[model samples]
Target chain A: MLKATVYVTLRESVLDPQGHAIQGALHSLGFDEVKGVRIGKYLEVNVDTTDKAQAEERVREMCEKLLANTVIEDYRFEILEG
Target chain B: MRVAVIQFPGSNADVDMYQAVEDIMGAPVDYVWHSHNDLSAYDIILLPGGFSYGDYLRCGAVARFSPVMEQVIKAAEEGKLILGVCNGFQILTEAGLLPGALLRNASLKFLCKLSELRVVNNSTAFTQDYSQDEVIQIPIAHGEGNYFCDEETLAKLQANNQIVFCYENENPNGSINGIAGIINERGNVLGMMPHPERAVHAWMTSDDGKRMFTSILKTWREKNGVTTNA
Candidate 1:
């Protein structure tokens, strides 16, 4: 089995209010070094296949179609073997 | 006039839409489940406001894949009038039936109030009853009502006069150009963030929404060469 870990984040141009609010909270907690934060989504999908190449392709398609909205966000994924 | 109000799992406004069309407009309307994929029987297709599928995986992403959406897309392409309100607007954007996507409100809070909207374009089938630049009041309830699109798309929308609604003075959700609603290139599909369905009755809200529904009926009437009883 191949496990795909996907990370989706808002594009840099877009402002993330949730992330900004969290950053404010972090600063209030005295984490001054953390100057910025952007919230994102993480997802994992396991493919029942032994071919790494095909698994990667499928993962990309999943990310483009459902996992990430390319219009406002960017996504990256890495595969792990069972 | 026969209309179809699509109901997804988390849809809470289908009943309101039904009442707006059936009780107020005195038209025949039916509820179509999200899992059903046929819309040929209806003249107007309405995607009402609600948090469909619990708003999972983005506002309207999951609901965009509902079985009924395929048929809705086909209907949109066939030049049938499609109206989407609030979450319905998000679904239309996600389904690629409309340009641009709704983003999180700049305030990051659920906004529920009466927002003054200007009729930017009155030439479309949905806004035919209203005069250009007329200001009207409509209720909006949403968390992600801010609209976004690329610069090119925005220019195209402006050039084509597809923008239908804009915030009056103050931009509530920080949408680009204060856009509250827009129509497709063919003027058949309209997606807006405000809840026009809730404004059909004067005892409830204002009756501004009535004209929007009438606009659709009039357009249909004209297309089919049907004369009104009056």
Candidate 2:
């Protein structure tokens, strides 16, 4: 089986208000050195396929179709043997 | 006019949409389940607000894949009028029926209050009843009502006059250009953060939203060449 880990984040052009709020909270907590904070999503999927190439292809399709809204977000995934 | 208010699991505003069409506009309306595959019979399709599929993953992410959405897409291609409010707007964006995506409000709060919106384009089927630049009151209730789009899409929208409504007075959710509502290029699909259904009656704060329903019915009647309501 192949375990795919996907990370989705707002595109650089899109504003991240939630991330900005987090940055403010961190600043209040005295994390002065933190210049920025952008929030995102992480997902782990276990693919039953043994073929690494097929697993990668399917996982990419999944991210494009359902896991990510590519209009405002960008997504990348890593596959690992499980 | 025949209207279909799509009801996905977790949709809380379906009844409001039904009542707005049936009671206010005196139109025949029905609740269509998310699993239903056909929408060709309906003249208008209303996707109302709510946490569809618990808003899991992202707002409307899972619900966009519902069986009925395929039919909705087909209906859009056929130039059928579609109005998506709040979470319905989110679903339309996720389904790629509309451009841009809604993000969490800049305040990071679930805002539920009346908002002032200016009618930007009164030529579309959705806003024909309102005069250009007319400010109207509508209630918005959502945490993810912020709208975002790339510069190219924004330019196209402006050039095509697809922007139907803009937030008046103060911007509520930090949407680009204070965009409160927009119509598709074909002018058949409209998605907005505000709830017109909830504001259909005079007793519901302001009845400014009633004109939106009337606009749809008027456009449909004109297109179908029906002078009187049957």
Candidate 3:
């Protein structure tokens, strides 16, 4: 099986209000040096195939189709096979 | 006009939408469950507010795949009127029936209150009862209502006069261009964050929302050769 981990974040050009609120909360809790933060989603999927190329392709299709909204988010994935 | 109000599992505004259409607008309405795929009989399709699928994955991400949404898409393509409010708006965007996405409010808090909206283009079916440039008040309740689109889409929207409502004086959710509501390029689909259904009663925020329903009825009547009561 191949395990894929995907990270999704707001596009750099877009503002992240949730991240901004978290930054404020972190600062209030004494993590004052934090300059910025952008909230996002992470997903892990296990594919049944061992073919590395096919698994990566399937993961990309998943991300494009449903895992992430490409309109406002940027997503990258890492795959591990066992 | 025959109106259909979709009832998703977690939808809390279905009653309000049904009441707004049947009682306030004097139109026949059908409460269609999300699983019902047939939607050919409805003249107007209303997607009401409230979280669907518990807002899992995304506000409307899961609901977008509902079997009924396929019929909704077909209706939109047939130029049938479709109105999506609050979570409904999110579903439409997620379904790609409308451009742009609704993000977390800029304040990072759920906003539930009355908001003033300026009618940007009253030529669409949803805004005919409202005058161009008129300011109206409606209640908005949602955690993710901040509308966003890329520059290309924004430019196209402005070029096509697709933006129907703009926040007046204050932008409560930080929507780009103060856009509170917009119609699709074909003008048959409208998605807005405000609760027009909730405003159908005088006891609610204001009667301004009733005008939207009236506008739809008026348009349908005109198209069907029935003289409008206006």
* Number of colliding residue pairs in each model: 0, 0, 0
lDDT of each: 0.92, 0.93, 0.92
Scored against the true structure, residue B201 in model 2 reaches a CA lDDT of 86
Stretches off by above 4 angstroms in model 1 are none
| Better model by lDDT: candidate 1 vs candidate 2 | 2
**Residue runs of model 3 more than 4 Å from their true location after superposition:** B228-230
lDDT of 2 at B199: 92
A-chain TM-score of every model: 0.97, 0.97, 0.95
lDDT of 2 by residue, B3-122 (tens): 999999999999989998987679888999999999988989999999999999999999999999999999999999999999999999999999999999988899999999999999
Instruction: List the candidates' TM-scores in order.
Output: 0.98, 0.98, 0.96
Report how far residue B150 has shifted in candidate 3, in Å.
1.4
**Candidate 1: which docking quality band?**
high
What does DockQ give for each predicted structure?
A: 0.81, 0.93, 0.82
Report the C-alpha lDDT of model 2 over A13-32, residue by residue, as the tens digit. Answer: 88899889989999999999
| Best of the candidates, lDDT | 2
lDDT (tens digit, per residue) of candidate 1 on A1-82: 9999899999998788889999999999999999899999998898999999999999999999988888899999999996
TM-score of chain B of each: 0.98, 0.98, 0.98
Pairs in clash, predicted candidate 1 = none
